[model samples]
Target: MGRLATLAALHGVATVHSPGPDVAVPVPDETVVAVLAALGVDASTDEAVQDALTRAESAAASRLLPPTVVVWTTPDPGTSGAVLPPALPRALADLPPGTGLRVETERGDTVEWPSLDAPPTDAAAPGPVSAAPEGRSWPDLPLGVHRLAAVAADGRTAGAVLVVAPREVPQPPPRTHGFLVQLYSLLSTRSWGMGDLGDLAELATWSGRELGAGFVQINPLHAAVPGDPTDPSPYRPSSRRFPDPVHLRVEAVPEYAYVTGQGIALLDGLLERAAGLRAAVLDKGALIDRDAVWQLKREALEIVREVPLGPGRRAAYHHFLAEQGQALEDHATWCALAEVHGSEWRAWPSGLRDPRSAETGRARHELIDRVDFHSWLAWLTDEQLAAAGRAARDAGMAVGIVHDLAVGVHPDGADAWAQRDAFAEGMSVGAPPDAFNANGQDWGLPPWRPDVLAASGFAPYRGLLRGLLTHAGALRIDHVMGLFRLWWVPAGADPTRGTYVRYDAEAMLAVLVLEAYRAGAVVIGEDLGTVEPGVREELHRRGVLGTSVLWFERDWEGTGRPLAPESWREDCVATATTHDLPSTAARLTGEHVELRHRLGLLGRPLAEEQREESAEVADWLGTLTRLGLLPADGGDEEEQIRAVYRFLLRTPARMVGVWLPDAVGDRRPQNLPGTWDQYPNWRLPVADAEGRPMTLEELAASPRLHGLMSVLRPSVVN
Candidate 1:
């Protein structure tokens, strides 16, 4: 066990702190062994541990450079006119004397590093520690993903990925306020029962141009795993790489314009059904049935597909196919196969289990039409996403269409099947036991294999980011700590038994910065809960903004009171509440406590929970009053909500996000974290104060919403 721990630590496979910093928590031996096994290391016994450790040490010693190297130029604004020194990697010190080094930049440029003095050629001797060539300085290279190659004097060749990134991501142009929404919960008159990319475009344009807002941040649009009863939570998606076709605005498809006669009659029937689906949620108080909506859209899409694409559109689609390449094919093929067999690939016939098997290939070939249909769906979805971005930009948004990225992929989803070798087998991404939940959490998503990711030079990660960034002016990464480390739970194990598995944070951040730079998008990390000590600092250093919710901003280490607005960090998106938490009205009215009690989700006595929640609200209200942002006599519900925005506006935070529901006093949380079937997790439409479902048009006209928006307006705030 001790040997395993030692080797685990050596391989960066274990962390002392999973979510806390006060006590040193060692990962259980069982967890360490399991995680090590996932990394392709055998550590089940003493003999195996010793053998693995020896091989690991030998491999580390023999390697002149790591599989990937990240170089970030520290931007010093003070040195305005002076040229700064190039950042150098310390691994250069480990290179053998007289070893030749070559750097191939992404732009087809190359730089050479001449060899230093030769040393002894003793095979058993340790790696050379000679200094770098004294007179030579690193070449000023363009920021991008590059390649590095090293040739030893003995003719042994080694290669690594060289990533040159900006020290920080570009920040938003100015302090601006925006709307934050669970996109699925936003229903419009034109939507097919639920919010689609069309709704996003309309909301972005109206909010940005008409309301003078700066951006519209929405939930993850990632693809969902298909099932009889599909999981509706955006956070647990099938693939983080592709947007869901269900969100496609069917009417916006170019082919929809050409549908005629019987096809048009068929579409009318589907549209009527869609109207009922939308009415069921808005008027009848029925849950949003994604499956029902998709059934209708699927039929309508088939008719639309029959209309041939014009030459221009055909060329554009062919270009998209060429660009997306094999990733699209694999994803489309998986979807096609899922329709025939089942969504869960694990339960499929043994011959079809492997994505690359002959049987799977044959199935893909036989179902080529279905595969092409799915592929077309993805391309249409992509076009709508791009159109949404264009709408936001045209509406004068500073940061338009800020998209959220899910943390991981579902175990039986497309990415898991296509990139089978890149995910850890039989392990789920989760959280360690923390103060909030003694049992912790298991997200049921497979984490990427760090070793495999490094071996592949993080191509999957880079590709996913590229896809999302294509139509995003800013990207929010959910549970951003996963980039540094994630809790790996053995399938079906208690979350307490899970342990932290470290990732190559340098490489991860470098890839993120490089992509964000190329896309000209801002990056925001959801760095809210149980963050490690230095993670926030590291993110800030790289120009990534952190999330800061008002309720969680109290000084825990000090006065246990509301933190002063002036003390809040500037590199954050400050908000009064998030989608997962209670709305401002619910908190102020103590309605959240009642709701939790009604749902039997209260962790303690209802009275005690109410008292604690009430006291917290009082503390913040007092702070707001002292700041002269609220009336001393205690304001009305709408006034208090506006006061909360005023408090956030006073902060130095670069961006302020107004939860769309909060504007209209929606009290229910969009998500109740611990319970699945116990609550309607992601089925509710955006509602008004009285829990009345609202359409985009109605929300725009709502007096309460407009009242709240007035408080956040730059003219009023300034």
Candidate 2:
């Protein structure tokens, strides 16, 4: 390895291998240097590399502690397996004997330990090097993000974040089945052309109470960047912290009821348009047009805003403003400014580019009304989110409303603009060229700069998680491997030229565990593909459930055959399909291959793709038959679907997810990963096998949906 690579690795800016152990793919020197540059380290030359390496080593040696320390909570006092306090690392081992230690906990209480020389009983060094007396331990700390500071015997002082996390996050209540839907695609009769939070609440309540579902996991509902033709994909959102009010049910707002005069007339006109838009999708079989829906909702919301908030509602809005604080202000300011300038902050005039500039401050002052309007929208969005949660819980769901968190935010989105300092400039998060995407993918989303995140004690990450977990019974982290490392593709470069940028996994997981612990929520990590060797084990240790898809549960190293139900991992939310892949029905009938061919998305020859896809399906069918999951003569597609779910139930997985569309034999995928414009990605409504849109009422009345639900329910199935 070159000195530049050495420097990058030392600074946690490089990876030694691809995600899998089979490939020891070294990051190129140029990619390492570019990634280092993004981290503010100029390692462009040999001299620069040497200088950076020396500085990095010197800095590490000089620090009394790392920027952050994560300590696992001790579960029981009498247990031999109780977690030990974090040991002082080699960097701080040379501190003088009488170095004093103190901790200020999250609950505003202070605790002091005597000195490094006088450690408590039962202290054991976590590593080979022992500093204090053997079997010594630090003072007990309550679970939280505490402040830790050490005053050396020579009077030198240094501080670090002290994170106390539970050994593992709380497990799921039981092995229960739930519906999984794309919130926007699951439109109801009352929706304003597109599904909203009100529809989400209704889905949760009806599915949970009537169907006995334990949870409803939905796609990320993060804010979208407004535009003439807005991007409909929920995965690439403008802000992950605050939800989009475009998903809000306008009539649910209390002020909506009090609108008068011209406002009522304006809303009436918008409603008429909304009715047409809704009809276009439901009756005419047209795809859901998000921008059209948003346009009508925006006009209607303007009229609703004119109706002044009642005293109680006004107080609640102010409370939300105070709670969200500066983050919300920055987001609101960006939204307001986007109305005058554009959504892309970089294209704004130099004076307005910097959010904290004096000119920007002046502009914000002038646009205070618009800013307040955006803030009010955020408050309204939050209210509906809380209502959905309440609806889920009241409907008797265990882990109600499992919200999905996208890997990163859009390049020109509110989060990138608001938290500019935290994002690496001129770089995007993506994947290395793997078996799936030969050319690899550049997601075009900026990654959080690890150094900057550490400098801020991971406040940005903490806040993001906290916001998502606030209204979620569980949070599903998409591409959860990102918590350890991210592929950083330099600007204007192909994804193949990107290198892995390592993050402090310990600290990242610690923050996640801490937040989820506080929220009393379960966490599911989407560790589905190309994960490094230890990533899944670490996530499992921390009580984050893994995502296991039925199609991919094969023993690759051994038989390459479909894994038996008993062989499947227990710590997962097992499902037959995901948004990115084909629906179960499509997979069974090989319609996914036909769909790809129709869209010109097939990478190989049509016959080859069809044959290979057919063989894969047949293999799974053979397994089902051998295991007696299928009837002797082999059942129809719907029966096979039920058998596939039965195989899932036979596994020890804690949760089973039923793709809502699968209940009615929806064959089309909500998203096709490879093609953007080639397919109507993210625009399809929940439809049956023949691609007919199905409303909630229709779905409720469908015997097909009820039969599928019965398969999940043991009592009805028996």
Candidate 3:
């Protein structure tokens, strides 16, 4: 076995070696190491072993359990119900020795402290309950969120008051709503190889005013690690706390007009190239060239950095620096380091790889200029995002822009490297084996250690949320269940060997709610898999919206039937599809399954199942016809699209999402899962159902597209 594996096995056993109340002391090192390794720790090294022991100790110390007993006074069991003064403290303190005490009451309840030995019967005669003790009033829980009902002393009746422990609540931002769109699928005439922010603004203006969309929800715009065939999945971001500047509309940069001084020629050329690139995507209907865009932007930014910040701009820059502080510094530092060390920090020089070592500090000072450039890029990206949100609002979007929060960042990237102490080393976040993916999938993103996060008051998580939510009217959290618990795949183990690690859902939720409340943003959880029981209920109670996708909306527990529109959950944002899956047209026509088959992604041969599935869909269409939901033959395609919207209108969902591509009959999905090379994944342009490229103008004028909009107008207005 490798040295690290050997050490990890030893550490695992040693860490779990706690002598039970009746067992012997000093468990074997081998046993402990085995247990520690199972938890994804390499305990071979002395340091690793020590770390495991410390973690175990910390977990034990922080473990919370329900109170042993809860007691309160009320009318005598058999007598006429009468108002009574209860001896609250005595009843709590007099519990059997070793029993934990929890005393709860309604607002304005009194606690008269006699001795701990005093009985409730010894208190004064029944009277109105005294005012609540000073500094003891229950904290104001989130309004409009659900709370679990408290049980009274009789066990047969509900308590008069409800006290909820702080938890994450997904509350909609105050009086705001907007349309949601997939950015790449909303191609414009001006886009280089794909859609840009300029197109986004126009779409927002049109949708907000014409369609009355409250918000414009978009996929995650998180920075991707720079490389060839750059990771197309936005969910695997280099850093969740920073936006990718590649999304910036080059012409939108203020500095673009001021290029004339030293290094100005270089920037001018790059800008010209960027403009050409945009022209190609918009004019020719080509695939998005992310690497090309990044190359051009990087060169332009290099020159822009040379232009000294004007006094006023300098002040703004300083303000941004102050706001970002260490987080920005760390992210920029990681970027600089990546230039020299590549994406995997572990492969770098030992001294430089350790984020806290003196060697890294020296490297930071040496690469100070590069770091500043990266920081500037982040600041500019932030400004544009805020501008987009403002534009949406100015155009009368009620909810403005809703941004997506990726579930995690790349393990070897900025956030993980910068916040190593906060993450569980050698462990990766993933899903447990399920029907969809029997082998399970490891995300290769490190997970936060619950104890460590709690100890630090969730500062890292809070900072990330604050950055994403700063200008967002609403935020969608990918894989929201991770807030409660995450399946941890230990490094070097098959995904099946991994186990679920619990988190303090209350604390995590509290932090999320607090941040969202501060940012005036609503929260939505992408809860779409093998969710534990009560998770959806808890999310609904917290006012956090859940995601209800058209394809998966089925009554799995009963006779398996696609969920009726009216039966959809009200506390959710209903959408036709998402970035990770095939678009609506593709699903309806079986293009996705065909593509998967072509890519050899099917577990079974496609020939056998494809025919059967196709027939099933035909039958489904027949049902739609029976329900009067199908369009008449020979009408506009938009008429058929309108039928789809009419179905959504039947649902009671508070918010509805319109995939940008669907509005224009774009056949290609923004992404295609399980294919890294055969498909462009995130690079496809918005195209029509016939696979014809459509520019922004053509999209606007398309009869099929406009017809769909006509159908949605009445429902949105109502």
lDDT-wise, the better of 2 and 3 is 2
> Model 3: per-residue lDDT, tens digit, 1-718?
4443344333222212111234323433453344355445657667875666567556544333221112222223243222232333332322232222122322223333222232212132332333223211122122211212222233321111122222344455333334556576566655545566777777777777766677888889888887666786788988899988877776676766666765676766765776687667666666778888787767777766666778888899889999999999999999999998788887899987778799999999999988888888888888788788888889877677889998888887888888988887777888756768877788888888765665554678878988998988889999999988777777777665566666767556755775675576788999998787778887776679989887678777796666777788888888778878777777667787888887888888887768866775565455455567785452244555556666666778878777767876667766676667778777776777777767767866676666666655654332
- CA-lDDT, candidates in order: 0.86, 0.86, 0.67
| Candidate 2 per-residue lDDT over residues 408-463, each given as its tens digit | 99989899988899999999999988888778789999999988888787889999
Error of 1 at 476 (Å): 0.2
User: Local error of candidate 2 at 698, Å?
Assistant: 0.7
lDDT of 1 by residue, 1-718 (tens): 4677779987777745645655777767888889889889999999999999999888887787898887776433443111223434667656776887877766666666656343322222222232325533454445677888888888878899888777778789769889999888999988888899999999999999777888899999999998879999888888888889999889999999999989999999999999999999999898888888899999999999999999999999999999999899999999998998889998989988788899999999999999999999999999999999999999999999899998898999999999999999999998887788888889889989998998887889999999999999999999999999988999878888888888989999999998997798999999977887789999999899999999999888999888999989999999988878988899899998898899898889998998888888889999999999999998898999999999999999999999999988898899988778988989999998889999999998888888888888744322
Judged by whole-model lDDT over C-alpha atoms, candidate 1 comes out at 0.86
Off by over 4 Å in 2: 19-22, 75-96, 118-137, 715-718
Q: Model 3 clash tally?
A: 37
Give the candidate number with the greatest lDDT: 1
Off by over 4 Å in 1: 18-21, 74-85, 105-134, 154-156, 714-718
